[model samples]
Target: MTDRKLALAAWESLFRAQHEVFHDMLADFDGTDISQAEYDVMLTVTRSPDMTARLRDITANMLISQPSVSRLVDRMVTNGLVTKCADPDDGRGSLITATDAGARAFRAVATVHGRSIAERMSALDDDELRTLRALSDKLRRS
Candidate 1:
């Protein structure tokens, strides 16, 4: 294959692999209090200090659109998974803080999800995993 064709093939393989892995990982949420989207939001929030994250930061990290994220956060608020408040630093901005219940739910799901990811990635050795991570980061940085 030409260089361009090789790149295309690699891209296609990466896309399909990611799709398959993500589909398999979704099973970790079975019977959980949070959906995958909610978990995505919580992943960012829970990792932040005090389990809080700015709405824009959450949206930036998510694959969802801004409106979708807004709606999701609103629903999360109603479900008592998180609390939303105006950012004290920026009047026009909002902040999201994971509630105690949200943290509990996230932790429960994360254990299974983390294991699932590791199991799936077990096909790659440590060196290969490091290379993959570096390549992925390089692509993102580009």
Candidate 2:
């Protein structure tokens, strides 16, 4: 193969391996009784620092439908991980918020999952880590 073709093949293989690694990390997260989808929502909500997110915003960020967002929020609330409340700014709309319990659970999951990931990547030296980050950023931009 040409040099460019060989490089492209290596990138594809690494990307697939990265996907598998993510799948493994998500296999056991129980925070909010969340699937990968719900946990993603939770992360976005919690990071916003407003302590709340609109249903529409969540749907947009999650790339899900309104009905699907509602269902996911309902399930999380039932599991004591989230709360759904009418938006004060617009009573017709709703917002989703994570409870204290939800934050705690998310933290716990992050701890375990982060440790597993760190351990796995520990073998890579600092230069390898930098290369990985640069490649990830490049792919994301592309």
Candidate 3:
């Protein structure tokens, strides 16, 4: 049986930790060409084949509303960070592809952000990191 009080306490701790860590990590984008949202969109796009991904897929991965993602994509398009075109396979959908400049910018910020993440998470050893990953995955799946 679950202990209700303990569960709430654990949830609060987890929430606070995630919030603080994320807040600290935002500094990784300081003075960079892209904001954190752009980095997130490119993170999904650059991982897909040919630096391309479906708009729906990007929206699904984002924490923001679909409309917000759409607007951000439009801005990225205006800035020449990416190209968006109607998806041939899905008439109502679109495809987003990172431009050469976009990929370069993502890479530059990723390097610094990756290092910052490592430094911050270094508080946990490899085994703890693995355990945390497993737990987080399990929770998401549940």
Indicate which candidate wins on TM-score.
Answer: 3
Better of 2 and 3 by lDDT: 3
Q: Which residue pairs in candidate 1 collide?
A: none
Candidates, ranked, lDDT: 3, 1, 2
lDDT of 1 by residue, 19-91 (tens): 9999988899999999999999999999999999999999999998999999999999999999999999999
Off by over 4 Å in 1: none
Regarding TM-score, does 1 or 2 come out ahead? Answer: 1
Task: Give the alpha-carbon lDDT of every model.
Answer: 0.96, 0.80, 0.98
Off by over 4 Å in 3: none
Q: Give residue 49's lDDT in candidate 3 (0 to 100).
A: 98
> RMSD to native for every prediction?
1.4, 3.7, 0.6
Give model 1's TM-score versus the native structure.
0.97
Superposition error at 71 for model 2 (Å): 2.8
Give the alpha carbon lDDT tens digit for every residue of 1-142 in model 2.
5599888999899979888888877766744345677677787778766678887788878767778888888888998888889999987888888899887777777677679889778889989999999988997788
Q: Tell me how far the alpha carbon of residue 96 in candidate 3 is from the true structure, in angstroms, after superposition.
A: 0.1
After aligning candidate 1 to the native by TM-score, how far in Å is the CA of 114 from where it should be? 0.4
